[model samples]
Target: MSWRIHHVSLPTRDVRETAEFYTEVLGMAESSPPWKDQDRGEFDIDLAHVAWFQGENAQVHLSRHSRNFARDNNFHLDPIINGHVAIEVDDLDAVRERLRRKGVYFADPGNWALSGLDQIYVLDPALNAVEINSQLK
Candidate 1:
């Protein structure tokens, strides 16, 4: 069976800020405009674009934590949880430098693994962990 990852949800307190973080800071291409489905009338859904590069088939869906859902479902993860979204970049160093110049601080500075790829980990405006690596495969 052939399976593909259509999307992954990233819960954020602010949708616009988080969406812009993925697009502007990480250099991810906006796949499409924000999607709003009225069928799910319980809450307003604002889905931003996604970025899938190389063999990595994944998209980041910025989900607004609805108060209604939280009230009814009573399911929520603490914002400080050690959660992250990883993105592979072609020019890791160049991107890292660009982000740094833009006031994005990296948690791991030039600390790479055996994949022979450099990785820079940072947090988005919503405090969501964002990883930029050179290894996509």
Candidate 2:
């Protein structure tokens, strides 16, 4: 399946500062998050604590760290605990099938963060969380 780095998420204590640093200092333009107006459903994220920056090919997501967000939401793998690299795959089902065959446990959050994204989380060998997602048609 075709795969590409969609975005890299970073946890910060202050979302506005981090966003300013990325935009003013790093020269990345601020981008609107897809979930801006959409309800998070059960994800329970504060939009005020999040920001997005656009790169040439990929994006950067900054979020305020919250220890309770994952546990409160009952997520097996916390996408923002530390941070995560989001990979966009051409076929999400194919990736899920491969993970199942390999006995890799994945947490399907299913578009909780972004609209039209079918997302799942997996831990890498180093125990770092990784997000695999595909755009829904």
Candidate 3:
């Protein structure tokens, strides 16, 4: 299974302002379908306000800061960081099996509320969260 660094996430108090900054100052363009959406029960989350910015190499996800999204292993590593690193994978099942064989633990190869992109969260040795998204095949 091939893995690629997809994007980096950051938590912000003001998603619009942050998005604009990334676009205007950093030259990152706003990604299409900038909002997160979901059915009532596809996942359990507070329906955070978020946006995405696209750079040359990777995308940037901006989520609004909130205490409920915090986790012990969150890369600082909870929702507290600028955000988490996302890895896009070709074979999620193979990757999961490999991680299992190596005794690595993870959570939620789950879909996003709006995008329906499947992802799983894992922590590094340093407790930094790494998000692995599926190819949806």
Candidate 4:
């Protein structure tokens, strides 16, 4: 499956401040709606607030916290990292099958709390969290 960059998500202590920094220093403008809360139970995550900043070609998501974060993710560790990048693909089913067959290690694809896109979490070799999302048609 051909992969295209979607966005990068960063877990920060303060979402507003992080967005401000990106907007003021990096010149990223708020692309999506204002920050809001999330209500999903996947990966033991309960995001309180999230915001997205738009750059010239990509997007950045900032979140305050995730309650009950994943404890046994691919790296067998809680996602204590930042700048989690995302990739979008049209054929999610094929990608899932390929990843499963190769034993590449990934999570079950599920709809996000607010954004109903189907997404799966996969960790890179360095244990960096990567979100693979798709809005299946």
Task: State which candidate has the highest lDDT.
Answer: 2
Off by over 4 Å in 4: 33-48, 55-57, 71-80, 114-116
Better of 1 and 3 by lDDT: 3
Number of residue pairs clashing in candidate 2, backbone atoms closer than 3 angstroms, sequence gap of 3 or more or interchain: 0
Name the better of 1 and 4 by TM-score: 4
Q: How well does model 4 score by local distance difference test?
A: 0.66
Per-residue lDDT tens digits for candidate 1, residues 11-122, read: 6666667767876898776554223333445333335322222224765655554445423533232221343566666667677678879987665534332134455667
lDDT of 2 by residue, 78-127 (tens): 88879999999999999899999999999997876677888999998899
Supply the global lDDT for candidate 3. Answer: 0.67
lDDT of 4 by residue, 65-114 (tens): 54445543333434335657888888788878988998898876366433
Alpha carbon lDDT of each predicted model: 0.52, 0.84, 0.67, 0.66
TM-score of 4: 0.71
TM-score of each: 0.38, 0.88, 0.71, 0.71
Alpha carbon deviation, residue 59, candidate 2 (Å):
1.0
Candidate 3 segments whose C-alpha is farther than 4 A from its true place:
32-48, 55-57, 70-82, 114-116
Error of 3 at 31 (Å): 3.3
Candidate 4, residue 137: lDDT: 65
Candidate number achieving the greatest TM-score relative to the actual structure: 2
For 1-137, candidate 3 gives per-residue lDDT tens digits of 57788788887888888778887998776765433353444433333467766777678778786665545223233533547788888877787788899998777636643364677778888788788886555
